[model samples]
Target: MNHPLLDQFNQWLQQFEQTGSVIDTTRLNEWNHLMDQFQTHPEQLSSNHAQWIKTLAQNSKAMMSVVEALQDQATDSSEQLKKLREELHQFNVQLLLQQASLPQQMAPLLFTHTHLSTLFNEEQLAKFEQLKSSLNTPQFEKLNQLIESFMQWQQAGQTLTEEMNQITELATQTWQEQFDDSLSAKDQIELWGKIYDNTYQVQFQEPSMQLAQSGWLNGWADLKLAWKQLLTQLTEQAGLPSPEQLDRMIEQLDQQRRRIRQLEKRLSALESGDHNG
Candidate 1:
């Protein structure tokens, strides 16, 4: 059984050989074995490949959902920030009004000799003047400055949230465009590849996108770690090997197999040398 892909691979291998390009024998052998398996069991290989592709499509759909979720989160954050800014402004206005009315409200307590005498002595009355002076000058100014700083901070936050919303919206739109139902599987895969490349470029170029990407990657990493831990615990409870343990076992087996292959190659070389001798 001949495959066009295998024929193309053979052509490339022949070209590499004619060009005297170095190729890893182990990798070449692996490719040859895989091709041989595909040739021998075309139906089984095709079925498996189709299943793998289906899995990829499912993953891509899941990714689309994640992107949409991110967009919703960003929009929610922007709205929340806008609401907070409005509340902050209202609070600042109320605070300033309270601060302005404080002197009038305390006038009798500070200046009325009869009321002052009931509350404190002459020394305490004198200190009240200082308190009034401080509040009227430095404290009032400081409160205004603090409110201004808070407003500035809120503005910065609003700007950041807006940028995040825009980026997420663009990403969502791009993904939706790529995931056309009319597109074939191969075209969808190619479009996804292009999306990845474009996203990679944009992430580097846009600082906001880079920050968003970093946060997303960190969140995903934490989620993956938590999932793995859960899996490990579940597997332990079931008296089965965890994925990490199985992976380590596979790695050790591969190393042992590689060592055996190397020994066999050396023995074959020695045998050939002896025959020549």
Candidate 2:
């Protein structure tokens, strides 16, 4: 139906058959030239012309064969290119399937599925199959739908992740406002229990909420580890809080307090004795 290359093929055929072309002129030129050269020595000239004509005819056949070979090679190369493109397209589809997440991974074997592949009609498939067996138009149409659906799924994931992060941040700030004070071990445990109770009471929409919760100490564990590491580094550098020295200082201060109280009472009793005297 489409005649771009076929018309060109026709035009080339016309050129070959035109005036002064080999296909027509070569047919009788050898005999005519030989006769014109040897009108006097007919026998010898006729023998030599016979040999020459045979050689020329063979050469023409060889030339035509070489041209035909080249044409075959060109057709082969075109077919190879079409096959390679179809392979690349199939690879792209497989890559999409590999990259799909939970919701996206729901639809499988898309090329075989009617809802996805129905977009391609018979003509499109025929054209595609003539090019390569791996990718008919139906497969290609399904590939398009899968890619579109996967992209939408990815966008949805991104939106959900952003919302979760916001919720995590809000939860962190609200908890800090409520319980951001230094408490003893008992009080800390009690407050943590209260938070655990509140978090347990709320129902979550995310099906994977339990998985999220496992990672969730709601960000507290990460913050604690970070600050503890920082403090450890600072304390090592300051060379303070040696346990033996703290205990020794506490003992000496307690002894000094008891001795000073005794001295104060003894002085008060001496003053009363002097007054009575």
Candidate 3:
């Protein structure tokens, strides 16, 4: 929209149309003269034209960086979630093996029934069922509830991770297709701007985006809460603090340390005043 050179060219076109046909020698000569002036003295272009192009390139790079960051976040979350799931799976396997070997002695532990079922072949399940009667009824019920809660958390985490990955892919594809270094700076800026606007709407305001937003954001929050619950239960069983509890303790300790430092400074100032007095 702000292409000064294009605007001048358009003005020349209008003059040519008004003054004479393209075949007119006089009009052609005038056009040639204009071109000669532009070619001989590039200063005819705005002084800040190069600066404008640089700014446009910088803006484009910044936008690409945002997409890259989002992609990285999605990738990190997916990997972290995968690792957490693997750890939880391994723990479940160990617990199942222990219970199957000595059901009467083993304490009840929560495991996602569906996921646990998948791990066991029919033979293993049949083998494990021999000790089912030995399970504490009340503890079994608690474990069932815990497993259900964990499943909800797992579902949310999966949904969020999937949606994040999908969006990142779409953004990356759009950026690549629209980006063109060969285009003139002004054309490039305009093209990139249009692409950005359309891409933004498609990526953020479309039905897919709306659904992702609703599901992923809330799912992530719910997963965090569920993780805390699971962590708390695990910590209690292990006679150790949950990560959340440890984090809170660390935060409180930091605050107290800062307060102590402030108080020490105040006490030092009072002593200095007293000595002066």
Candidate 4:
């Protein structure tokens, strides 16, 4: 009787033996013992056990491929972010130099024998200079701050991604180190949960994560506000009630319902008093 499983097991054993450094001696011994048992008492091999083993092998391979893909994506994104950060830094430097040279560059146009110089007197030129100075007002300062903040947010996002990749790799290594083939599916799930909890705890303490969280929250809030504004504009354009108007209408309806409830309570109280009398 030719046993397909026995043949397969023998092939696996032969491959494992050929690759001497693939597994430790103890692990190799364990595989040899299992092979021996399978061959000696083929009837003792449970279909359930075989199925479980096959499923576990498939899942492990799938998980490893997913981890590798994620690692590659993170690496690529990190490289792109590095390039972006460098470009942004260069752009900022150029922008600052251009801003600094603006007055000097424009002064020649206003003061020298140009069309503007012929058209405007000294007083008008002074007013134009004041107008130029007004560009450095509080609003412009806030705009500059917003730009700086956006840059910081991008840097923080990159840092957070790098930290996450490191944590993922560490967690994967730790899980591999602690993995036991003898453990049941439930036990493996519990082990994964513990690994996830530990990784999250470590990640939560990271400064990059905190900055990224804040940036995400702020961005979400801004998005919501912008969306609301857009909705309000659309509603107004369509001659429909805006969000604020709808809110006020809902509030008034609630107040009217409360007043009606109060009146009903008073009427019931009066009727009860009359019946008592």
The candidate maximizing TM-score is 4
**Tens digits of per-residue lDDT for model 4, 1-277:** 6766667667766877798736555654665555555645545455547655555445555554444444445657565444434433333333322322212332343333211111223575456446546667664543333333333433444444455556555665677688797999679869966985698688779787677556645643443444455456667779998977887899999999999999999999999999999
The Cα local distance difference test for each model comes to 0.52, 0.46, 0.53, 0.55
C-alpha RMSD of candidate 3: 21.0
TM-score of each: 0.29, 0.22, 0.32, 0.37
TM-score of 1: 0.29
Query: Candidate 1, 135: how far from true, in Å?
Result: 48
Q: Which ten residues in a row have the lowest lDDT in candidate 2?
A: 110-119
- lDDT tens digits, residue span 75-137, model 2: 685554344334334433333334332222233422333123112345645543443445446
Residue 25 Cα positional deviation in candidate 1, in Å, after optimal superposition: 66
- Once superposed on the true structure, which residue ranges of model 2 sit more than 4 Å away at CA? 1-137, 183-277
Global fold similarity of model 2 (TM-score): 0.22
Residues 10-112, model 3: lDDT tens digits: 7878987786534355655655555544444444464546555445445555554444444445657565445434433444344433332312211144322
Candidate 3 lDDT trough over 10 residues, lowest sum: 98-107
Evaluation by TM-score, superior candidate among 3 and 4: 4
Candidate 2 or 3, higher lDDT?
A: 3
List runs of model 4 lying over 4 Å from the truth: 1-170, 184-190, 201-218, 268-277
